[model samples]
Target: MHIQNVRKWCREFAEGHTNVHDEAGCGRPSVLEKPVTKVLFADRYVIVREIAKLIGDVSKTNLDKILTDIFNYNKACVWWVPQMLTDEHKKKLMESGPTHTSPAPRRISLPNSVGKPLNNHTALTWLPVTTSFQNLYCVLQ
Candidate 1:
């Protein structure tokens, strides 16, 4: 790797490089509810509705993280204090959440102290309308 690249990246960050998954994201994600709508998501991940609803495979490990983040964020609770999940929690997630044939790769955003975790694809925009890669990193841990 080029040292210059590191410098460029560092200058783009705030204080230093942080992780998006710093906060505690464990167990099944809480159900998604319409902040305005009264209908409950049946305590299920509506990620199905977000993209294509085709019944396909979702990796277990990846789904676990997604579920954990979804659950905590849904409840307005911290998402990355723990950084991981337990076996029992994983089992619970499988039992409670959607079904997939296999574990595929995944990319997810995170919760933050300031706003929210930016999706892997979502560009980061810091306060004062400034764009920052460092500020964009998840700052829970």
Candidate 2:
């Protein structure tokens, strides 16, 4: 709100340029929209830094904001997608579910310590294990 600028605005208003919005003037223009759209359509996994470089000079912060706010993308694992999952997205995810694996069963190991044997051939021990699904303790005797 400089005095000179204010006077200029008043003069413009008096002369009938009465639009409330600021006139589009030269400034740091948006550098991401079109190129980002193209890159994303081509390859969703394209790195953000690479996209920024392709679109000329743009700060990482500004580019991130544009991608998240304008594009509605949030990072999941290594990819970015819409914050809210759509039905089509869910269907695609389900269709690409993990392949079934049937590895041979392996014997579990336990720590060797100073413990008395309950029987001549068996010893009692508590083994703590962490699994992808849950944590549990195994009691063996």
Candidate 3:
């Protein structure tokens, strides 16, 4: 193979699209190291060589194979919690900002009273079951 082919092979291998499958699907490593070594320790796990023999012991060749073995294209979708302002932030906003509230009307309600508006004077009348004559007072005010 030409030197250009070697470079192309290295690049392709780093992307982890090599043909290494059995009757079952091929297993790929979780991560790939920048420079392939005898042993690469990832944050999750240490990836040691599965096969002991080293056909191409050089860093470039080793890196290519290791990268081809690991670094799967399939990515798992995960829900990530983002950083947000805390209760302290809300308290600060409340202290610095103007407070808002609904306005309450100043009026009283009577249990059996119904109110109506009229421009003319009206007479007030009443009926009493227990007494003989019942009177009611009213003003135009």
Candidate lDDT scores, in order, read 0.35, 0.49, 0.32
Cα distance off (Å), candidate 2, residue 129: 39
* Best of the two (1, 3) by TM-score: 1
lDDT of each residue in 64-103, candidate 1, tens digit only: 3443443332322233322343455445434544358755
lDDT of 3 by residue, 1-141 (tens): 699978877887799968533435457642335433334322111222322233234444444354444533111111110012235533542454434663332221222212321112331211122222111111111
lDDT of 3 at 34: 43
Off by over 4 Å in 3: 1-22, 25-38, 42-59, 73-141
In model 3, which range of ten residues has the least summed lDDT?
73-82
Per-residue lDDT tens digits of candidate 2, residues 1-141? 799999998999899996877768757776568887887656544567877787778877877777777776644331112123346644644554444774322222223312232122332221222211112111111
The reply for model 2, stretches above 4 Å from the true place, is: 24-31, 53-58, 76-101, 104-141
Best by TM-score: 2
Clash statistics: count for each candidate: 12, 0, 0
How well does each candidate superpose onto the true structure, as a TM-score? 0.21, 0.43, 0.15
Give the runs in model 1 whose Cα sits over 4 Å from its true position: 7-54, 73-141
Ranking by TM-score: 2, 1, 3
Candidate 1 vs 2: which has more lDDT: 2
